[model samples]
Target: MAFLRPLGDTGLTISALGLGTVKIGRDQGVKYPDAFTIPDDQAVRELLALARELDINLIDTAPAYGRSEERLGQLLTGRQDWVIVSKVGEEFENGKSRFDFTPEHTIASVERSLRRLNTDYLDCVLIHSDGNDLEVLRQGTLEALAELKRKGLIRAIGVSTKTVEGGLETLRRADVAMVTYNLAHDQERPVIDYAAEHGKGILIKKAFASGHLQAGHADPVQASLDRILGTAGVGAVIAGTVNPKHLRENVEKARRAVGDL
Candidate 1:
């Protein structure tokens, strides 16, 4: 079985690998290495079913990921069994991106996410930083999320930080932190170490370097998985794949990476 670990003190146990739902919704203005067709509803449902069969409980989505929340609300049936991780501070429209971190927008965003996700509360909500992670935190975004947590609208709150300083600040104040870590780039490693020492949840993005590994190098997937999952304090690595075979291979790699631990 794949390893399951606690997401900090959020009382949520997540599998070593989480499913990212970006390809399910938005295909425009994406950073993925290749262009691909967005899966239809039936195809997405099948992929999600495969994820559950692999014991992946954490699903990472965002309002900026076009149509993802609404599609999930439509396709996802059993809500309580999965840990839905959504985001604030970013929205996509007309093939462009916009950001908002005001307290009102933050609260309203969470409410809108709840409705779009067809759930009363979100398990985790992270600040989708527009590369200004510290400013977002200083401008009352984290406060609004904390208020929501107090009101039972969200269970855990954190930030998807871009800079090391911002990531450390988030760990000082939040329950979890999402940072980009992979074989090619590892500048945010200090954040991971801080989370490990402080008992904060750490979610890795771009675990496969946005498909950059597929081109060069041998066994890049296994190498990436081993590096990230072998590190302490890592909760889950969010890998976005619409391909069932790819997803299965990732889960198997994760299982091998976190063997017996």
Candidate 2:
């Protein structure tokens, strides 16, 4: 089982590795190395059950991730045991993507997510950036989420940022920041550094470079997990995999990585 850790000052204890649910919902607009059929209901159920058996408590999903939130709504059991992290802003429809960062959209998005996820409150919500991280912050996305947090619709607020500048600002405005960090890309290291010093949460996306780093190498998974979980500020690493074998491998590698520290 994966161990637990605090997500900065948010007062939420999350598992060291989070399950990303993109594969359970949408498959059209993703950048994964191999094409996949969306997992059936029974498959999703077994995979989620395996995740819990492996001691993963954090589940990362988004409205942009096809029907991920909706399926999780229908499938997940014992919501109180999971730290659900979802996103607002970007929406996927008709194989196209659109972005909205206004306070009105942010507020409405959270409400919609609550309904689709079948949860009265989400553990954390992030602003999904369309590569315009600074502009989204200027648009008061965090302020709107803060309002929801105050109203008890969500427990923690943050942004899945694309820029170091945006990440720094997000740490100032919110409780957590989800940034891309992997062996192949460390440009966002500063954001993790800042979060480390400031007591803010840092969640890593693409910890295996969306599985790109898993091939043509010896022990790529362990190498990347070592650098990521070994870092001080990293609260969790979110890796989405529907394959039970790969999920088990990820959990084991993550355990060794954190255990080494």
Q: Quote the lDDT for 3 in model 2.
A: 66
Model 2 scores a TM of 0.97
Model 1 lDDT tens row, 44-144:
99998999998899999999999999999999978987999999999999999999999999999999999999999999999999998888888999999
Q: Looking at model 2, how many pairs of residues clash?
A: 0
Off by over 4 Å in 2: 214-217
Give the clashing residue pairs of candidate 1, or none: none
> Which ten residues in a row are the worst by lDDT in model 1?
209-218
Please, what are the lDDT tens digits per residue for candidate 2 over residues 1-261?
Answer: 236899998999998999999999999979998988999999999999999999999999999999999999999999999999999999999998999888999889999999999999999999999888888899988999999999999999899998999999999889999999988889999999999999999999998888788465689988988899888899999999999999998888888988823
TM-score for each of the candidates? 0.97, 0.97
